[model samples]
Target chain A: MKTPALIVSGVLALLLAGCATRRVDESPVAAGQTTFATKEEVAAADEHDDWDTVAVVEVHDPIEPVNRGIFWFNHQLYTYVAKPFSKAYKSIFPKWVRHGIGNAYENIKYPIRVVNHTLQGRLDRTATETGRFLVNTTAGVGGVMKPADKIPALADVPKADTGQTFSKWGAPHGPYLVFPVLGPTTTRDLVGTAGDTALNPVAWVGLLFGGAAWTTAISAPSGAHGVPDQMDRYDMATKDALDPYISARSGYIQYREAASER
Target chain B: MKNIFFLLLGLCVGAMTSNASTEAAEANLRSTIDQVLVVTKKGKGGQSMANQLTPILVRHMCFESMTRRAVGPGWRQFTPEQKAEATKLFSKLIIRNYSKKFTPGELAEIEFLKPSSPGAGKVEIPTKTVYKGSRYNITYRLEDRGSWLITDILAEGISFVANYRAQFDVLVRKGGAVAVIASLKQSLERT
Candidate 1:
């Protein structure tokens, strides 16, 4: 188990190194100017009518080539492995059973959300989230049901994360990215994800408990719970896209923007 | 005095007409979903369901506008024939892709919330789709082109047009209108 973890860490380090070096300036189109002058002429002629040119000029996708490569890798993994596994998991379990598992996972990850909200100085949300966690854990039977939602005070509190906390701290969403097995993200969100993972109780258990207990905690519940929903979201975002990678990126950016508004 | 009374009455009638049209538009959208649901329930793959949905989609969706927006500035470069061809291909592509989403027994029901008047001629209807035990928000943005036709769709706030435009930009930059048309053709073939 340690061997597998070490190997994953090593591979990730290499990937990150690759990503670090490939960070080009904002315009990826500049690279194509030498090879595609005719296309550039067309772009120049109809510059005013081009919404894509105007809209994305500000969005710094410096390493789009690498991002696209990662996107393809992620797509294949989803298609051949993750999606099938998610479907199988869904088929085997009843909806309520799956929901219960998801609730449990969400409950476990409460600390991350609560901490981020606190960091962002959202004291009201932090308090409500804490109350919700406590209520759900006790009243909802270890959060198999969201009984806390019944409580008016807890119902309207928005979910927060390290990513939002980073945003609140004025960190820019540095370039669009596609991580292997993780799908779409940005540089800031990637850091936030890392922070969230470190803050996760399951990760702590894996560290403190060690060996079999750690493995069981990591491999069970949390790992399996959210796969179906993730797959469903991916399908919805990419199904109509002429290019799934482009569509997924667009959807992700828009989704993040909407999420940030909350 | 008679003219003033007539003007007030006309304003009241206009408001009622607008309200009635909004309701009618919402109803039309629901019926369209029902039709799609029927095809999905049939569980027949390929040309059959595609054939059933093509006309319904063509009538109810603003593919010409959607395709134009998606293609962006590159749209101007396309000739009349190219524009028409691209629109046809893009529409077919959407229909083909969308039809694949309807899995038998998956979509339980859809509940449309109050239609919001986003603009003078636009209505945005937010619907909650209950699939199995999960609920997802799918918003339909329709424009009044004599009838309410779907201009865009947003699943959990991810707009279809915006997403496609992001991709179409890169394609246009790398190639041009010809490349975009070619890419659409390839996508159609793949589907």
Candidate 2:
């Protein structure tokens, strides 16, 4: 009786909350959808544009030589290797298939997200992340398809990470460093990255279950997944600038800062 | 039971009709972008290309709206004259910065994908583009102001509006409209 009552209440709640949202409807108010610029809304809007705004965070690039050399190496790698591979991968897979793969990868990183969310004391976000994980894992066929994307409570929330957690804790970003393949990072974020890697289930499997071949197979696809996207965006952020290095550095810093704030 | 069936049938037709409109919106956006691309292809470079693109951009992009939102809540403190100045300078600043991103005489291969209506009068048209030897995903968000006008652009999942707003909001909170105007001027000069 209680279960039936709870199910009925859930149905009623969803029904009451639902509204007829149209696609490309010619209504005036749709232009000014009351999604206001609250502090929270910034993350939902996605990553930053290429605007050079006044609110600058100065990155301490003490190891400029190392960073620039790695940046140069990475640029060459991306141009020569990643670009061709990504083009081939994209041609082979449809957008939905690629998106599903991306969703699955993101889904598997649930521990890193939930842990960071918890560390930052974002209980609500942590709860939603857990809910998203459960729903995606069960209904989404091990999260190859993202059924949670349709859920109002789970939609559009940026995934949390250890770097963001540290930033929220008021840790200053130390020297900027760029790895050959992994690309840009600050000293603080490098540590965060390591911590995140430790928390990842895939990393655990590789370590514990001797899943070397599994990791190798997954690694290639993982590397290929976002190469086109990352390289293209990197070009957009840094290209045609007076100093490409400076532009890339600033963009990286700004992106990290924005993500941390959210 | 009869009423519910009719309601579902009505919704199905409504969706079909709206999907048609969404295609129209996509067509209109493609046309608008082509005009801007023509200007970009001219290889005018720097301020020259920006100046040419401004009129077309102005026709399609709501600078006043962008200016208002980018300024965030601090826009309320701005006077009429200041708001006008901010909008003008901001539009110029954005055009210059954005136009600079395009290389002269290079046209990107853009593939427009399925369009979705996130709400009444709002359409998000996603595109995959191969530009300058790299592929990128770009999404254009349009709102109906009698006609569809692009409100925001996302490049590789980065929001153009949110990026500007993040910086502007900080400045506005720190120093108000004057600071924002000054920052705009400095950025414009640098560009």
Candidate 3:
């Protein structure tokens, strides 16, 4: 009996030793303690199999504390204010009218697209965007209708923006950051947003028309026109996410990369 | 020539049958999801209701595949008992999330795009789902294994399986199977 027991103990010891040498898992393993608590863990988890093949852009988030705080702020702003306002606006207006308003806003932003396309050295895309703008402005009645959409060539021009232009210019996305209302953006992209804003006629509404009321009137509807779609994306990313911040950050990067490439 | 004609006829009939099978799979998924939403939307969604949902979800979702894939290469490291525990835990976690995820009547406004074949034995149903005035694009990916069953879901391009895998990969790499099981338990409890 002593000999058999000794053999069993020896075998258990060997198995325990093997387990110790192989995996050095220092996590506390406490229930309800740490569920995707850090982005470092996500970034550190590398390609182990085919499932990991889906590219999740890993961005350096040095100001994660600030970003998280801002992320929380943006989420609240969207949920409480933006969402209710949009719902009210939707109730007031039919979808087509809102869609037309949205299209008009998109049309107003064409200068940014065209200029960025030119900067990116895509003359063909620049031409297509210019053509789209002209067609939508004239026949579509100041972009309320997407007449250009009927033309297959003008329909699917990949949207170009100042951030994509910066990417094309070989600028790296430096330090991920989230703004209070603006949500997620990088330092380079923030600068790019400023550049794009400069190109936007909506920003000029105050200077050209010259009144806070006029700007607000234009901005309110413009924001309402597209805010729902963005909120939708935000909800999708964060709804069932393990870590909402990491999920949003990774998603933002992946989308930006895809847009730039597209 | 007669043999050739018969072979061609058989091929045509097989093609039609396959197409019908694919359509049925998509229809089945749509029905299953609608049923799930209906149950969730009910005033009193009790343990009994959840009990009923589990079998339907089990029938339609390939939980084992999702668990294996989400665990990544470290799945091989787990002992047989450990593997079984991990799979069971993951299924519970996923089902809990799935059952409770809808925002009041989100699926009521769902507009399912035509299901398309991504590859052999796989079909994808893309839908524009709405909740609280927000329109979300969610794509359900199903694999045919005797029956068409969901393997993964992509919400606005964020994959459900890959999302967990990122977190699990870290734990699996650092602590191994025990760590993953613990974290999964933690996630289930919190949700």
Candidate 4:
């Protein structure tokens, strides 16, 4: 019952994210360039004394209530709900199951990577696919892929080598927003959730709801084993964080950069 | 259709009944953990147990959610060049963080408690993970699937979302999402 509701609600939420409210005046990109020029230039600009010409740039966009709502929804679902569930699943499943779930997700995306690589005319993508397929099928399936062998090549594909589905219907990257629960996301990525749902095979796999839920329930302990460590690291990063919004924004940028490299 | 529904009902009922009797589940885990420990003691190399188990421990708790939250936004902002750089660096950083936690000579143990009644189509499973020999009560609230899939965790009183939020907030504050991400990627690559 909740599944259908979630799906339907997600669609509506995406629509909210999709609302085209352009705030042209507020955009930094509209006039062009960063408020803080590079140190060398700032020093140069100071020496020349173009301080009066310097202006803070900002991106202006409509405040989409719907998108905010959807963001909040995902936030609650993940922070308060899905995250805990993941821990539970870790507790019940054998190492094998974890590997299986990991492999399945990687495998399902293999074709997308293959297509992306083929389009790019790049050996890197092909190489990555080969590695992704092999490791995911063998080591990942076995739940014992050596750290040396765990490199997922598919994740290495260039963004330019995006899947056909993405190029054809990919949502445009909207203004970046810090979601309350889900963390950082742009409007486009938010909409991507809808697309992901439409494409998710879990609905057919019979693990999405009832069956998978119970299994996760049992596995929670294994998942929770290292939560303290993760928390500790997070604390280190944010304890003296001057401003959460800016920090989160910077972190997301760094994270995306890292994701692309992977 | 009626028969199928009946079968589904039967399965649901059986699951409910079985889950209601969770003493067996707790006992089963206790025995398994104990057996693993016993094997480790008798094993030729103390290293074997640590090597065999630490990966699972790290892999399971590497805190992918933190990375996900850290990466999900500004995904579109990155050029293919920036994106690639960011992704690889971030992954390395995450791995490094995990490596730091699962350090040598740090004693850690995980014990399954009992399952609570399911809520919001999910269930709460209690456990305690002793890290560096300090036991902290942890809870795994899981959503249902044919086979369970873990998506989140809570340790002590901190939820995964909160932990990630703290980290991400720093990023956002430092440079908006994009700047935060860029610096993180730079740091990850530098390491």
Candidate 5:
């Protein structure tokens, strides 16, 4: 095989390897057990189940310096390189044009979401995606595609919310991770990043640049712009000082709780 | 030689002109949003606030940037039509509810924190909100579309993305997706 072929083969082997071995840290909550309720609603339901109180203890909180290092790496890359292209895109593209591009990107991913959910054993996602696509395509401006899908019928309630999607396809909320600029993630989700990028048109487009710098240059500024908002959001969630990490952990857990309910 | 001179002159003049225009546009956009922000912070009416801020925000911010963080990665999933619809509905719903949730008086003391340009076209504005004797640090991302428009907002650490996820999750549970849409639409109408 040629050099490029060898590289491709290597990448394929790695992906295959990733699939074969399941890390305990990466095991997502069973999709069947995931819950689809908002924090408030879950609390309001008055059904104080044992799992509801399951804490998301910080298995590891690397010092602020480590967190800062990741943050800077992520932000610096976005600020200098990726942002300029996004600016260029904004300059050339009209609002409608950008909207169209964004839509195309989203619509292509439904199957992936479906597949991921199915793999995780999330039945709600199966139903949710069904309704999502049908209704989104119809009432939602010709399914130009929006995240939230709403149809007239609440066809399956208990099954939908109880736990379905997360169980089947959820990337195990592996050990706690604090990315440089990407912020917090886990080992499993980090790997899922590869899958996500594989399916993303932007990533494919960025790859044509022939190096990571091009991708970084195109993506960084856009990422930088989001930092404040992300930080602000983090602050808002944690200000109650009620263990936000845990809240997020539970949210993710309940997110998968649907499978158990099934 | 004469043509080359003219071309050179035109290039110089064009650069000067464009820069002037960009500067002016940025200033105008900045001032307009500042005024608009003040109006919103007032929180006087139920639905009027949404009506008032919509044009200003739309003009200052692009739909994609405003909702990216709020909506999460899933935002990329919206179709152009869905994007527009979601932008209209989600913006209205979120702003109205946020205005209703926090009083202008409570936020009176909060100033817009800076470092607006961290890099690229991204900007962050620190907004503070006080509730039940506690001060909260809220921030919003302003993506540059040649000017600033809020892309996403964070209340403390909780972003609209997390909140919306949680909200939709609950709504999905309560009545499935249909209920979530109905609830969102109802809220949009009310606001």
Candidate 6:
């Protein structure tokens, strides 16, 4: 019993160490501009600032060539395989049923959001989200319906994630990455995603059941379900672009920036 | 007693007028979204969608205000003409971006909810859009400027203006207004 407990503790410590290794240094900010409390505050400052000299805030992209190659490969995979699979999935499941499943998935993933919100010191969000989970789990019939959102006070509980938490903690987005089959992401978000996956209840249950196979089987579909919509948006965003790659990069960066802001 | 009664009546009328304006604003937004959806379903290409949506967007969206906020402090430096040019470019960029996001098959249904008053003269109208397998929450922030115009949009609590500003702030910091405008132009040309 003592030996098994020691091994388990050792494994947990190693896992945490792996996560710590993924965090890069904080990104540099411009002169006179403090790290903003909210994205809106940054915009508000922009509205009030006078014309001054400029300083570039560089996006660190050390392996652009490799990332671009992977981006192309992901695009092909999405267009050829993932999109078709998503289409079939859509056709098989009616809109309402699919929505229920999505809601259930979101409900199950509450721990990810709640933990991240708490880590970011958003107590109000943590409470409200916890309330939402409780209400949805029971009143919403195991999260198939989102009745809590109808409550005015609970309507706008923001979606918190590990990536956003890392940003709040001043972790730099180390480099742009186009993950194979995952499309556009950053080094920071890549790490955050891994952490979130590790924290997922479904993944843990699967690990308890049939180990890695069950975990992958359950998690893969959730990731795959959103691919078709993502691909469509990508196609639309880059339809008439001179360089689709640049457009995708700009869009992704802007999206992540806004998303990470409180 | 008569004077007091008239004052109360005036207050009542004011409340009614405010409620009426909010409803009108919500209706206008719904109609705009409906028109865009219809155009999207027609299988119109990007340019056509952009053309159709731009006028409606300009009419309803507070582009001047949004542009000012997006450009940040450097906005004071530009001439009125330059500001107008920047606003146009920004509007075009947004329209193009919006056009790209309009996939007909993905959106199964859209339902507009009652407007919430966030503050004086500002209302947030929430809409639930159901796609293939998920529901997205979108809130339009409308401010009354004679008529109600959208100042910002929040999708799942992420503001569109804020997102653009995050990217634009960096660009403006590195280069001046020219760089920012050039970047917008480049994005527009690409889209």
Highest-TM-score candidate = 1
True contacts kept of each: 0.52, 0.05, 0.16, 0.02, 0.03, 0.11
Candidate 1 docking category? Answer: acceptable
**Alpha-carbon lDDT, every model:** 0.72, 0.71, 0.72, 0.45, 0.46, 0.69
Q: In model 2, state the lDDT of residue A213.
A: 78
What is the interface RMSD, in angstroms, for predicted model 2? 9.4
Between prediction 2 and prediction 6, which has the larger TM-score?
6
How does the DockQ of candidate 6 come out?
0.15
lDDT of 4 by residue, A170-195 (tens): 22334666565445665555554555
- After TM-score superposition, the amount by which residue A13's alpha carbon in candidate 2 deviates from its true location, in angstroms, is 47
lDDT of 2 by residue, A1-262 (tens): 3454355335433433211111111222223222224433333333332122223234466567787888888888888988888788889998777777777887899999998888878889999999999999999999987788679898546679987776666565666778889888876677789889888887776777687876666666666777766776776665433345655765676667657766
Each prediction's DockQ against the real complex: 0.30, 0.10, 0.17, 0.02, 0.03, 0.15
Model 5: per-residue lDDT, tens digit, B33-135? 5666577566465567666766665665555444333332333344676556655666665555444444454433444544445445555566545443334
Give the DockQ ranking, best first. 1, 3, 6, 2, 5, 4
Give lDDT tens digits, candidate 3, residues A1-262: 3454355345433432111000112332224222322333434554533343333334566677888998988888999998897778779988788788888898999989998888777999999999999999999999989889779898657788987776665565666779889789876677789889889888888778878687778877787777776776676676655567766876776566656666
**In terms of docking quality, how is candidate 6 classified?**
incorrect
Q: Which stretches of candidate 4 lie over 4 Å from their true place?
A: A1-28, A31-100, A138-172, A178-183, A190-240, A257-262, B1-191
What is each model's TM-score for chain A?
Answer: 0.76, 0.76, 0.78, 0.48, 0.44, 0.76
Better of 1 and 6 by TM-score: 1
Prediction 3 global C-alpha lDDT = 0.72
Per-residue C-alpha lDDT of model 1 across residues A1-262, encoded as one tens digit per residue: 3454355445444433211111112234433221112344444644334333222312446677898899889888989998899989989999889898888888888989888787777788888999999999999999899988678788656678877766655555666677788777877778779889888887787778766577576758767777887888788777667788767766776666556556
TM-score of each: 0.76, 0.54, 0.64, 0.36, 0.34, 0.61
Model 6: per-residue Cα lDDT at residue A78: 72
| Model 4 reproduced share of reference interface contacts | 0.02
Candidate 2 residue runs with Cα over 4 Å from true position: A1-53, A211-213, B1-53, B58-191
Model 6 chain B lDDT-worst window of ten? B157-166
Each model's number of backbone clashes? 0, 1, 1, 92, 65, 6
Query: In model 5, which runs have C-alpha deviations exceeding 4 angstroms?
Result: A1-262, B1-33, B37-43, B68-79, B101-107, B112-119, B127-134, B166-183, B189-191
